[model samples]
Target: MGLSMFALSRRSDARFAPARSSAELPPSFLGSGIRVRGVLEIEGELTIQGFVAGRIAALKLIIAPGGRVEGDIVAREVVVSGNLNGRIFAPNVTVEETAHIDGRIFHNTITVARGAHFDGRMPWRPVNFFETLDQLPETQP
Candidate 1:
């Protein structure tokens, strides 16, 4: 009877355990020597050190120094320290000093370092607007 009770308590504890956030999950990495041209989707975090020419959807994305991307990115948060010639649709964005961007950024909150080279428009959106990224208009405002 004691063993049964202990098992039940253990199960309860497991059920009530806090869920892990995207930052706490293991990150996926794309090496510097790699190149991909397709849609990339990640549930947790993704770090890129290579070249990608397609759409990327992730919970969090980091473009490391020397990385390059040419396409659209939709994420909850994004950090760029490389080169990008595409559009970004994220609620939170950070452009490091080493970043060079030539496209549009749609964000609710954004931070660009002093040395970052950016030649594009940064459109501000409400937090609720990002809740439905799939419904984004095809034309840029």
Candidate 2:
């Protein structure tokens, strides 16, 4: 009985765990010298230590310190530790203490660290909203 309960707890925790633990899978890294301007799509985790100016679709995304992104991001999980200047459509988001964020964040759950700098709105959405997000939202002029 105790073993069954332990298993159940582990299963539940998995639902809220990071997309992939560093030990389980290596994250694709973009170095500081790189700069990109286009749509990037990835099925696994990605970590950015450079400059990006476009859309990103991934299972998990991390903007490392000193990195910058200027576009939209759609992912299951997002962790920002640098600068972001656009929207985020994710079920879970974590804004680190060094993060600088502007624009909107649409998330089912979000955490902004004490030292994070933010200048935008965070709209809570149901998980179903993300499930149907096949494309980016049209811009409003």
List, in order, the clash count of every candidate structure.
0, 0
Q: In candidate 2, which residue ranges exceed 4 Å CA deviation? A: 1-17, 20-26, 135-141
Candidate 2 lDDT over residue span 27-70, tens digit each: 79999999999999887889999999998988899999999999
Best by lDDT: 2
* Residue-level lDDT for 112 in candidate 1: 98
Compared with the true structure, all predictions reach lDDT values of 0.84, 0.85
* 2-119 per-residue lDDT for model 1 (tens digits): 9898655633442222222465788899999999999998878889999999999887889999999999998878899999999998878999999999999998788999999999
Residue range with the least summed lDDT across 10 consecutive positions in model 2? 132-141
Query: Cα miss at 81, model 1 (Å)?
Result: 0.2
Cα displacement (angstroms), candidate 1, residue 30, comes to 0.3
